[model samples]
Target: MRMFWGAAALVMVAGCQAAKPADPAVEKAWVRLPAVQGNPGAAFLTIRAGNKPLTLLSVSAPFATRTELHESMAADHGSSSGAGGHMMTMAPVKQIDVPAGETVKLAPGGKHVMLYDVAPGVQPGAKVPLTLVFADGSRMETQAITLAAGDAAPE
Candidate 1:
């Protein structure tokens, strides 16, 4: 009887150690890019996960050699105009918080991913598939369509 109890305890510990982490559930995602002409760069949509905290490991797209996370900022102090004033700039964000029943959006002048050096001749109406990996070894895929240059984002 003692031997049986000891064996069972060891098995339970082993099982716990071998258990795999669960994947986070993605709620919604989107992206933004100029339509008329493809630029050297592009911005991606924010992601919102349902009821779980997950770390974003990396992002990839076939259209570009490398995809980097970036943020855009509007200079508030006339920095662009050569005033040398403090610019209201937005920098790249490392992580995002996804609260339960709420969504975290990566919008213009905010937290977003930057797609650099796109494939030659990428045009509007093209769909780009992006794969996002999480820290728990789970992945999510999203497709973003190209928008026309000067086109306003949908409200």
Candidate 2:
């Protein structure tokens, strides 16, 4: 009867609806190649948040002895006039926030993940595994390809 047709229509409509996408997280992660061993390196990535805001807790890499989230800031050299060379320094940060439905980019000369004391064996054309820990106790694993020191960022 009419009730049976109504139920069939409802089921058809439900079946036609597309499934929702998976949770958003990190994407397009890459690590800049280091000039030499035992030197610092930088990592860049974009964090896409889901319904709730995401906080980057920490970063870990196999090539580096220690890895930490860091931000670069311009230093004030006690110069009232803007006539001196700008000095930049990097400092450790507890967490980086990625607002809901937004992407936070970690790039060179800006906020980035700092890798200290990189191993000598880690060379160009190598694949470095990076684990990004979030505040929600979720972790995303990605691979960063090591490029030449003079090479540009991956497209």
Clashing pairs in 1: 35-147, 35-148, 35-149, 36-149
Q: How close is every model to the real structure, measured as TM-score?
A: 0.64, 0.78
Worst 10 residues of 2 by lDDT: 16-25
- List candidate 1 segments past 4 Å from native: 1-39, 73-88
Give the per-residue lDDT of model 1 (tens digit) for 39-152. 445555656664567667667778777766666676766566666765656555565555544555766667666776677666666777888877678788887776555666
List where candidate 2 sits over 4 angstroms from the true fold. Answer: 1-22, 76-84
Residue 95's lDDT in candidate 1 = 54
Write model 2 residue lDDT over 63-151, tens digit each, in one string: 88888899998887756655675777788999999987778999877899988887777777788889998889989888887776788
User: Candidate 1 has what TM-score?
Assistant: 0.64
Show how many residue pairs clash in every candidate, following the order shown. 4, 0
